[model samples]
Target: MDFYTVLSRYYDLVFQKNKKALSMIKHLVEIDDHTSLLDLGAGTGEEAIDLAFEGYHVIAADLNED
Candidate 1:
C-alpha cells in the first residue's frame, strides 16, 4: 500500500483523543452560518466533522488522503 493509505488506517488511533484543542478554538473564535473554516493539515477530519456538525462551512485539506 502507499504511505498515506497505510497511515490513514492508524491515524485516528493517535489523534482521535486530541479533540480537546478544538473546544478551545471554538471558544476563542466566533463562527456563524455565514462563516467558513479552512482547516489545513486536517489529518483524519475529526475537527472538520465537528465543525460541520456545529453548522460551519468547513474545508478540510491534507497532504494525505486519510
Candidate 2:
C-alpha cells in the first residue's frame, strides 16, 4: 500500500475538523443561493463534508487517491 493509503486509514483518528476555521469561512463567504466551493488539497474531506451539510456545494480535491 502507498503512504497516503496508510495515512488515510488513521487520519480521522489523529485529526478532527476545525470548527473555528469553518466558522470563519462561514463568516467570510456568503453561503446562500446554493453557494459553491472548491476545496483544493482537501484531505479526508471533513470540512468539505461539513460545509456541504450546511447547504454549500463543495467539491473536494486531493493529490492522494487512497
Candidate 3:
C-alpha cells in the first residue's frame, strides 16, 4: 500500500486523535512568540498546517514520490 496516500487521510485524525496530549504539550511549550516545528517525513501536510495555525513556523520535509 502507498503509505503516504493512506496517511494523508488519517493526518488530521492524528491531531484530533491526540488533542488532549497536544494541548498539554502546547501549554508546556508556552514560550516566546516565535516557535518552530519540524514535521519530518511530513505526509499530506496536515500536521504542518495545524502547527502553523497554532503559531508555529513549520518545516515540513519529505521524500519525493511519483
Clashes of 2: 0
Give the best candidate by TM-score: 2
lDDT agreement with native, every candidate: 0.81, 0.89, 0.64
- Candidate 3 per-residue lDDT over residues 19-56, each given as its tens digit: 56457757776535677667676655655676677777
Q: What's the CA error at residue 39 for candidate 1, in Å?
A: 0.7
Write down the TM-score of every candidate. 0.77, 0.84, 0.54
Worst 10 residues of 1 by lDDT: 13-22
TM-score of 3: 0.54
Q: Residues 1-66, candidate 2: write the lDDT tens digits.
A: 788889988887888888898999899998788689999978899999999988889999999976
Model 1 stretches astray by more than 4 angstroms: none
lDDT of 1: 0.81
- Model 1, range 1-66, lDDT digits (tens) per residue? 797788888888866745677788688778875788898999988888987887778999998865
RMSD of each: 1.8, 1.4, 3.7
Off by over 4 Å in 3: 1-21
In Å, residue 11's CA in model 2 sits off its true spot by: 0.7
Per-residue lDDT value at 45 in model 1: 84
